[model samples]
Target: MKTLPILLSCWLLLSSCGNNSQPAADTAATTTPDKPAPAKAASKPTILFFGNSITAGLGVDPEQAFPALVGQKIDSAGLGYMVVNAGLSGETTAGGRSRVGWVLRKPVAVFVLELGGNDGLRGLPLTDTRRNLQAIIDTVRQLSPQAKIVLAGMQIPPNLGADYAAQFKQLYGELAQKNKLTLIPFLLEGVGGVAKFNQRDGIHPTPEGHRLVARTVWAVLQPLLRQPMAQAQ
Candidate 1:
């Protein structure tokens, strides 16, 4: 009984120790640092127009070239795409084949391939043309599987032997079929052989003829551009 006070003091001390030693639950709100809003995806699809002088806007005034006209159409139609012309004057499939590797480095959405005209003009071998064009398609596919390809077919001048001309014209169709690609049969269409449509040389097109070419290109391209997978991300 006399030690009762001592026991009570020990009990109090233990109670105080327990209170001090017990861990309190943390109630602080933990939140992820407010992340910056994700960047908006680019609205404009990028189309790489890879070809020869036709794409380069060569021989025509800058504004009157086929690529420029195509750009205007894209803008007017509100397709939300930009066209990049990598065309060079007097370029052949062999040259294009050599250059295409470097060309693939760009962020290309789709390729508007208008090669083979110079090849035919220079009387290059059919095998060389086929190899070069096929290589282009293959390279594009390898680099960008989602890329849509539109091959603009060019006919050999009839002055070339009939057999060779036939083979050259047939090549475009065959490539289109084999690769499941889109074809703009006879890129010049209404303008190729016409006097009013061509330049004085009768080989290249005049400004009016380029406009028609752009219109023809647009007719085929607009449909593909409308397709969902055809646009770049």
Candidate 2:
């Protein structure tokens, strides 16, 4: 009951936020004819984080976003990967499907799929969400065959109905299994539903919450980065 109101309020806030602000630019790399070859060679492979407000670091400085924090971790570990945060506040799986092509203009080594939360919060049709997500995944495979996909699982509060909540939570695992993607059991794990971890929004995480999110992601991502391609798959 209370959780439903919280999710509803979050959806409304995110919708308003989306209208007021533009989503962050897709930080994918581009090359020009005049670009120096050595500079190109020095460039690191990209790890693209594609998702919604949570990934966009809404209500916080861009640097405090989990993707950026992950970039910091990568640097500290001396991993040769660049993070491109392609998070769009209020984005749904359908929106992600529509825009993912532009985001994939540049090649990426890893693609972290983080959409669908907004879909669940809005009580949209689960079938549509699943279809759109599968489409996005198919597009990624078509365009970036070598990229490792990391699916970020999400859960909706039971206010929508226990069955809907159960299905929503189960969708991520289903998608991951169907596509053989590396999965993050629940992106918000320790932060979700925790009053201290969320901002006034009671939706988006605080800076400290992002740190916890970054850690959760890193636990799965770190090993992938360290493993050989054949083994990682």
Candidate 3:
């Protein structure tokens, strides 16, 4: 994730796109001026994509975000699952930790945790980041014991210093191993630092970049999708 100002500016740019696809229902917070209505229970299982602006589709139409693209892939493949993009712009691990419980208010078949980029960007302490992430994981497990989780690993520029960068990169692998979770080693595998794949800001992905990201996420997500629901627990 980029700085707040950069993300806000990018959001403004993307939000101006007249044809932006509607965000997934689960992520949209709506209210009626009259008496509040009760939420209807979901008819289908949900694959919750939890993350920051990247997952929020910062510089592109909402439909172009990888999570929404993955949703399209699911529909094309005839998978009867709903995709919930719970991405909030400029979110850090601590922020995610605090909000995950509310986000998990419904049953989730799969939880895709894509966070920590902002923490890394802000040069937050590694220990605090790990702790907050672990707390989020623990909350998910506690709230939805049977839900399968996929962790999206992120990286920051080496300008932070090699040791710090290397440790940050390794942290995901260790967490995935310890938690026995499916891990996407690098969320930006083929697109990071690639001029053509990113927006002019060089942090967020472009429409094409989101497609590549969808493929990366799909590689791991597809298997989990194919697994029998009862067997995944």
Candidate 4:
């Protein structure tokens, strides 16, 4: 213990001679911590177009699609918002249900629901179709409680049987009324039977057809837009 203390004293003496003292931090300074991600810009209110090929504007200029048209109108009106096209070609109501969450991550203020056309084309059962669509609406309302819903209806060709078509079209009305939402009676209003209005595939709409669909959808949309965000029921 005596030898250890002598060695420590010699080490201290050598250290002092070598001037190895620790430096003091400057106290007259301010520390600026990193800024928090700039708040992600608080994002402009978003419009989510969650539909299938029709909404995706397949086989047409992407910028000229109906959703794009709606966005253009909203922009021109200075709504201070952005639109998200979540449309996937060949999507069904069930598919919409499956991906609803991923789309909702955006700051969506309004939702344009246009699915089930493929389901109608594929001649899916009405019960299954209705269930899927209902699930999607329920999921979306849960995500954005105050978000407005504009459900677009699709019609099946007569060859598919009137019974099936009746059930299919009826589903939209029932769901819309039940959910307290606005309904665009038929998405393919003027384009369903007109070859000039649809593409060669006779499924997706032509550019002009899309414009018509936008006009039809907009009729329901116009009144909704008049409702202030705070007063929207």
Kindly give the number of clashing pairs for every candidate. Answer: 0, 0, 0, 0
What does the lDDT come to for candidate 2? 0.79
> Ten residues in a row with the worst lDDT in model 1?
1-10
Instruction: Pick the winner on lDDT between candidates 1 and 2.
Output: 2
**Per-residue C-alpha lDDT of model 1 across residues 98-198, encoded as one tens digit per residue:** 88777665445668899999989888899999999999899889876778889999897777799999999999999999999999998989988899988
Q: List the residue pairs that clash in candidate 1.
A: none
Q: Which whole-number lDDT from 0 to 100 does residue 82 have in model 3? A: 64
Q: Against the hidden reference, what TM-scores do the models get?
A: 0.79, 0.82, 0.83, 0.79
Model 2, range 1-233, lDDT digits (tens) per residue?
Answer: 00000111222223344333432232122222343322332245767888999998999877788988888788788876666778889999999999998777665688999999999999999999999999999999998888999999998799989999999999899999999999999999999999999999789999999999999999999999887744432
Q: Per-residue error at 26 for model 1, in Å?
A: 59
- Provide the lowest-lDDT 10-residue window in model 2: 1-10
Which residue window of length 10 is worst by lDDT in model 4? 1-10
Candidate 4's C-alpha runs over 4 A off are 1-42
Ranking by TM-score: 3, 2, 4, 1
Ranking by lDDT: 2, 3, 1, 4
Q: What is the lDDT of residue 1 in candidate 1?
A: 6
Among all candidates shown, the one with the greatest TM-score: 3
Candidates in order have lDDT scores of 0.72, 0.79, 0.79, 0.70
Model 3 per-residue lDDT tens digits across residues 1-233 = 11111122222222333233332322222212232211221345668888999999998877778987898788778886767778899999999999998777665788999999999888899999999989999999999889999999999898889988999999999999999999999999999889999999999999999999999999999989999978554
